[model samples]
Target: MVALRIRPAIVLFGDSITEQAFGVEGKVGWASLLASDYARRADVLNRGFSGYNTQMALPLLPKVFPPSKDNQEGSGILFCTVFFGANDACLPGERQHVPIEEYAKNLETIIGTIRACFNIFSSAATKDDDKFPIILMTPPPFDPAAWRKCRDLEEDGRANNVAKSYGEKVLELGKSLGCSVLNVWNLLEGATSPEVYGRYLSDGLHLNEEGNRKVHEGLMELIGKDHPSLAPLEAGATGEGLAVEEKLWRELC
Candidate 1:
């Protein structure tokens, strides 16, 4: 029997923001964009759980990515993006609210688990030499004005300031731990006006098509710079003696 070529996985783990990454209704899903970019290059696995916070994500880690000795060559997780904090940034007394301090700890634990997987699965002689390929993403900015139109509530469940606070914590953890970080909050912060901000979101909480496009662009930029080997191959490259070959294809002819 021919041994099949194993494709490494690029895991996208997070909350509803992530779970809805493959958004419908003609909405462009950032996760889906990544999947397209990495087609035949790697598998993008979406492990986003709707309405989950760091606390909830902790318990689900082991089950989602069980340690395996067979994670060699093209197999196993090539990299993972840890993107939580949206739900956790909810106001105090809110259903999904998680304290900022506890949120930090949970993030650390998650990063550690991904590192451990590298050591367990990699053929590397020492863990110290291998830098784990992981990206920690900050939650996107919350637009309270847009949110109010959708929900009939006396009080807002989430606040932009609170979300910024969570984003800051993620940035801090990423710097201290030396992992790649994506500040989605800052990335999408350009929509300063209330009217403009609505364009990026579906219901103030979820991302719309244009918002997802911006995110995909940022992620691709990071990957191209930080994890160049894992970045998607571009089409039309000429080689020795002007021999051209097309490496880009969605499916076989």
Candidate 2:
């Protein structure tokens, strides 16, 4: 009997929230936790960049998924989670409020490019078993009252609303592209309150430890329900069976 070998590679790409590894202590970033959770079964690559928007990330996709010049065959990328748009919303001047139409175009480009790369590089047998699961995560809602304390309330509120609207549009686009949509805005809204996690936010935006956990848990639930391969591993269970626990402790400490 031939053994069915499963090789999973997850690439997490996004903004500061995806890049942050902060907490009171004994805590790891959600992406890192995700990596640790599947440490035994998969190779997780952290490609998250702080303050990167969709436009910026589109160009860097090749870096995360470089094609083999020698045409060497191996297990292709199994999953990719792209979370951008937050920084695009925060950009200065005309670029600040990225039009929903342009945002959709950028997302479509990213997904199309990835599909093209996989088709061009991976083997037919491997590609048949390896599904390219692209998960698009929307940005969580910003606290208007919190933003009021730092920046102009009216302007920030307007920008926040635009971001929310763009997020919804992005979800629609993801559906059109046959990708999974993780509505982080709605997920965080249900799991936490602005008054509670709002204080944990560093700069009227982005999450702290508790907030991060909320996002992570929401993601886990979403993935578990939809992706069969990820059902067994939970956020809290990672770093337990291997040397990851020690490393997690050191980093979190």
**Which candidate number would show the highest TM-score if scored against the true structure?**
1
lDDT of 1 by residue, 1-253 (tens): 9777667677899998888898768676999998888766677889999999999999997877666655445576678898999999998898899999999999999999878866577532223437677899998877786788778666779988788889999999988987889989888873375466657788787888988888899998987766665566554543211111234465345
**Estimated TM-score per prediction?**
0.86, 0.73
Which numbered prediction scores highest in lDDT against the true structure? 1
Q: How close is candidate 1 to the true structure, as a TM-score?
A: 0.86
Residue 242's lDDT in candidate 2: 21
Model 1 regions more than 4 Å off: 1-6, 71-74, 123-129, 236-253
lDDT of 1 at 46: 91
Candidate 2, after superposition: displacement of residue 133 in Å? 0.5
lDDT of 2 by residue, 56-88 (tens): 777887776666533224545556778887766
| lDDT, residue 40, model 2 | 55
Residue 56 local lDDT, model 2: 75
Model 1 local distance difference test score: 0.79
